[model samples]
Target: MQYINPQLDIEQLGRAFQRDGRLLIRDFFEPAVVEALSRAVDEIDWALTYRDVNGDRVLSGEQLRSLSAEQRAMLVDGINLVASQEFQFSFCTDSLVAAAKRGESHLLARFMRWMADEEFLASIRRITGVTDINRVYAQATMYTRGNFLVVHDDHVDAENRRLAYVINLTRNWRADWGGLLHFTGPQGDVLESYFPHFNSLSLFRVPQQHFVSYVPPFAQGERTAITGWLIAA
Candidate 1:
């Protein structure tokens, strides 16, 4: 499953990403896979209201601090529990690792095969130059909609987390339609942006400040993507 595709010309992509801390490979996903993912997301319940730190709906309040004491308790509990939202999808960061750690191999085994498949993983390795990934240290991504992740560096505590990878599942996305990911340089300077268009797979270094802009309400539809950390062993 870890075999390399000789025709991919990975060294060039690897060098570019190393120099700039980011790389975008256009048309990385096959049309059929993209369509299947798009349909999967469409089946989820979409939400305009989101629960905040307080148990109340953030969309219904003027500020997060405005919630009552009872609401605040609900918010605290929810913080530890992640639920699917119409606009975002996030899973427990350690789900895959925990399964592997307990000697349960099915989830991770399926994932390893998925990553190595030409329809999936080969292109990623060609661009990322990652080798001998540690199965116990990785996790699955929560693929959801309009999830605008704010600017921040990747987890500072994950020792092996050197890069972030995103496989675009968005179709017909446009620059003006928004949901653009902004990458900042080491000095807090704006580096570049990539729109969530079809077949766009992006990889970037971990320490960079990056944020995703909100998907405009007027856009034809919400955007989606599969994201995971590429860690060192």
Candidate 2:
């Protein structure tokens, strides 16, 4: 499916980005494209991983194999050891680039490939004025009840990340349901919060402090999104 933006003007978008350091574009993708992407997300298998309070991955396939039976049980039962911050469930198709190199083809893979296309990158450059962007990185994330990510500036100078993006796919989400993206000021006070609205794209400049609030136990549905960074070559 083709990416369509019927009403957006690149110059206007760039002006807004310069004024605020961030932008929220609703209906960023065509309705049909969003539907297909949402279905693809539902069909993928997600691996659950734990992150410590400092936002470091503490448990995974290899790590689990090294733990004793009792340690494994504690992890499986969701018992927080001294280091854990929260649980994370996600599917990262990091092999898409490699598959493209080998001439592999699939609907989802092709869609992901388009994300790194020069045309797409050029469009982003016009909107954000980040002329150096030459690569795209992405992963699907599912934030179920109790999952969260703490505040941090997504800085990795070596990666040359220019913009962070999230494509929300969860419909009918309420503000009180949690999982909101909260941005903070340099003094640690909340500057703004964005609800996880379906088919909306949220973009922020690099080095911005932000966090995804916890999904509460009483939330009615899962919060799912495709998140990634636009990077320099």
What digit string (tens of lDDT, one per residue) describes model 1 on residues 72-146?
Answer: 567545632543332222221223444444666453434444553454444555566655333223343322333
* Whole-structure CA lDDT of model 2: 0.75
TM-scores of all predicted structures: 0.61, 0.82
Residues 1-233 of candidate 2 have per-residue lDDT tens digits of 46856777778888998899898878888888889888977775554555434554434435546789898566545534422544433222223454466676754677668888876788788888888888898767777776666677788857888899988989888888788899999899999898888998888899799988877879898888888899887
Give the count of colliding residue pairs in each prediction. 3, 0
In terms of lDDT, model 1 sits at 0.55
List of clashing residue pairs for candidate 2 = none
Error of 1 at 127 (Å): 3.2
* Segments in model 2 whose C-alpha atoms lie over 4 Å from true places: 52-73, 76-104
lDDT, candidate 2, at 47: 46
The 10-residue segment of model 2 with minimum total lDDT is 86-95
Name the top lDDT candidate.
2
